[model samples]
Target: MSERKPRKDAARNRAAVLAAADELFARRTSPEDEVTMADIAAAAGVGKGTLFRAFGDRTGLIHALYEARVEPIRNAVEEGPPPLGPATPPLQRLPALLDAILCFKLDNRHLALALEGTGSDSPYQAGHYDRWHALLQAVLEQIPGLTDSDFTAHVLLAATRADLVEHLVGQRRLPPEGLRAQLASFTTKVLGSPALPGSPAEQIHS
Candidate 1:
């Protein structure tokens, strides 16, 4: 019973920490004010030591929280129905994937910014960025005449960057739906839906 009790307590502590962190993130508008390990420990009714033990450090905790939030979208893209699922046509799924990303950013604005940051630093090194870039590149490759699929994917994903979305929605005051439509339209033009834009693919990301 002693061993079992510790395991149960660990599970409970993890859950409490994640819940507390979510609430804190939801309330704060800026990552600078993001919940600290001490704050999270207090809110979760645990000790700071426990929070550190569970998540390593502030960045690790943010990484966990971000991954937890993105899991549903990940699952939907990997296995769910049309537009997001693997079975959908590459052309159709491409826009749908971008739309999903935009909507995710809109829905989890604070957390998204916290995870990816609002800085001008390149996020290409992040794991999520790599996953998205690879998936998008694979899809673009399947579309005939769409050369330089890799570069195209990166540029396309850039259109939905966390900071970009925040700027468009928070500062520029563009409606979320309107931003989405513009992205879809921009994407359609690039993909040669009705027809590809005259600009060459190599110059796209540059």
Candidate 2:
């Protein structure tokens, strides 16, 4: 027998269930909270069996939620900015990358908070940090009069991370613009000079 397509109502129900689960998981408190399949099914107005059939289990559902939320940020960083080229000055590209990074964090604050609450070990976290560190290091390496220990680039990247920004703005009440300027200053200092004079990529550090 040919497989039957799901009825329109069934499709709607599935969508509703996923949406509900997303909301709950996004706001779930404590890893110990019992966010059972039943809770998600009820929230979505679907049957428990439907929920199970749609998503293998709670972990699968959580993973789906995270992927749905975070994919855009990853894409923006990897592709949205100007292409990384030898001719392009890191200083100019750096600001664009920073702007994109900040926008991602601000847009996904709630999801970020949820992820932090889970305390899960994610390769994405390490990979993302490594990528940022690498990019900054590459920029520094291209500049003159600014060679240092390998750890310096990592330290600068870590200092200017999204989590630190969230803490500074959300918890410490620093204006976002002010924080951005301060971070730019710190980054420039860490990198030594923006660019060499007469170089198209050169930028003033101050």
Error of 1 at 155 (Å): 0.4
What clash count does candidate 1 reach?
A: 2
Q: How many collisions between residues are there in candidate 2?
A: 0
Off-target runs (Cα >4 Å) in candidate 2 are 1-43, 46-63, 70-73, 81-88, 117-127, 134-150, 160-163, 194-206
Show model 1 residue runs off by greater than 4 Å: 118-121, 195-206
lDDT of each: 0.80, 0.58
Q: Which candidate is the best by lDDT?
A: 1
Candidate 2, residues 107-204, lDDT tens digits: the string is 55444544433435542354355666676667666666666735766666555554666688767888866776665566566656653232211222
For all predictions, the C-alpha RMSD in Å is 6.1, 6.5
Query: Candidate 2: lDDT of 31?
Result: 34
Please give the lDDT score at residue 145 for candidate 1: 87
* Candidate 2 collision pairs: none
TM-score of each predicted structure versus truth? 0.88, 0.57
